[model samples]
Target: MGDITGDTRLQSRILEDVGAASHYRAWLVSLALDALGDEPVEIGSGHGDYAAEWLPHARSFTATDADESRVAFLKERFAGDSRVRVRKLLLPSTLDGGFSSAVAYNVLEHIPDDVAALRSMAAMVRPGGAVIVFVPAFPLLMSDFDRAVGHVRRYRRASLRKAFEDAGLRPRVLKHVNWAGFFAWLLMMRLLRGVPRDSLALRTYDRLIVPAVRASERLMAPPFGQSLLAIADV
Candidate 1:
């Protein structure tokens, strides 16, 4: 229950209709979809984009977010879509039984109680079901941009795995992402500590920098850059 309703330039930049960010987000959703197979529940669904992406493959889909307005919008956006359902509920509180898989993209970092969140997700799914998460990587790399976006903390693979394990879930995959872009971000933003959030510089980075970095992800394995992905089972 962190106060994330802040108006910041960084929020505007990342949540805006930037193609590169959308592409990377979609790519991550695709990975979750592959792991989920024909049906899954999506937690922290912002605008329903991730659920929309999985609609064709998913037999049924449910999405929830703490933001009531966003949930209302999602409900309207998919009103007639029999495959989709949207609701407003806080994390782990809204989770319940029956889902075979769960997804929480770029979400764990925002919660103050990360371990509790993981445990709630574990309790929601069937014993053998999967829970996949994506979050910003490396606590040392935390910046104002993270704060603006309401991130309580960044994570390393081991720490994230520990959280899941402590919640009675078994880690299946945990890795870093956007490796090539990590140094660039560090140099331009973290080290310099001068890059303004949502500036032209950031836009340029998203356009030019992200494509190159995403291309490199295919060549490398997990533990790549500044973002982490973890998949665990209940």
Candidate 2:
């Protein structure tokens, strides 16, 4: 997550995909929300989707993005909401924004120096404040879609834990999510090497598959998953 500009075309397509995965997004965000305390800040808040969902829960929210167009969109999206503030910032940021929690979803993998970026997020918050994030899991799942979306690398449990520890953050919740998604990603993303576009198949999965997986995970955490959720203390 350097100061380098993002590929807007690629970003737009990915954001569209997020929009299509309604239940999927809701479940993922619900899990993330449980970890975030009040006065939360999000890094790389693409298209403000997460911010919109998270803002209602947080007393005050800060949403930052490195892309200029995304920043503008975020400003417009949250302009009427006084409790929300939007900023243009890249990872490894120096700003001490005085937030209780710093978060990012599917953002860390884009950073070549992810540990520095995590340290920067930790710096933005007060002591004992949390740094929460959700990132793609399993390097073997690295597909053309990941590259097309600007991912530098996917992560393992140990790798993510090490990153948190190296950044002086103690992991409070570091686990894999979406156990079934691991197989779906391996076949659709890795084997196929194609991006997930808006389609009936995606919506069907969101409707039928997501709920069952989420419920099962609540009962028992799986050994591995398609993604990793990490909540750490600064």
Candidate 3:
């Protein structure tokens, strides 16, 4: 949600046309959901791109966004779904504690005060609960696409781990994802300064390369990637 920035319609289209990208995202969500309880919360649920996969597993799910427009869209998207609730919540939100788990994907880089945001996220969960986060990796890979997407900075493993520790969350798992995507992003977005959009090249990458890269990561994760994910405990 926080990762792809643009008009809401444009964002939805981007997610839809990206083909196999959705599978990779569902894999990440599955990893996060492993540690989650029945009642979970998703922060920055833009357009609910991954909602369909996550919703059925939750006893109750709260999808929150900083943008009122996005919240409205989510409200309509989940309308009449008894298990789901949509709300507008700008971070450092006044959210209460005791949720089974908290999750955010591609969100930390969007906030200027990412540590504070992590702290706020941790506060929403109960003791011994999980807080899963996924964020873009490597500041050097940043470009106009990242800027347009409202990314302040990308993360390294250490930086992300530090943020979790500072937030009073115990860092449990950290791994890089999408090995091929690292170089592809650098060449397309950084060196070439490509603008964000849905395209045949991206579709090919997602459809062909993504599955291969994911399969490789199962044996041993790459040292660097286009993004990093962490599973922390509160």
Q: Pick the candidate with the highest TM-score.
A: 2
Whose lDDT is greatest here?
2
Q: What is the C-alpha RMSD of each candidate to the true structure, in Å?
A: 3.1, 1.3, 2.8
Q: Give me the displacement of residue 119 in model 3, in angstroms.
A: 1.2
lDDT (Cα, tens digit) per residue for candidate 1, span 2-47:
3443343454445544423555556666667656845677877877
Residue pairs in candidate 2 whose N, alpha carbon or C atoms collide under 3 angstroms: 1-111
Ranking of all predicted structures according to TM-score, beginning with the best and ending with the worst: 2, 3, 1
Error of 2 at 206 (Å): 0.3
Compose the digit string of candidate 3's lDDT tens values, residues 35-124: 778888888887886665788787888898876777898999899888988887767666875888888887788787777888888889
Give the clashing residue pairs of candidate 1, or none. 176-223, 176-224, 179-224
Give the runs in model 1 whose Cα sits over 4 Å from its true position: 1-13, 17-20, 188-212
Global lDDT scores for all candidate models: 0.73, 0.88, 0.79
For model 2, the superposed segments whose C-alpha errors exceed 4 Å read: none
- Residue-level lDDT for 79 in candidate 1: 96
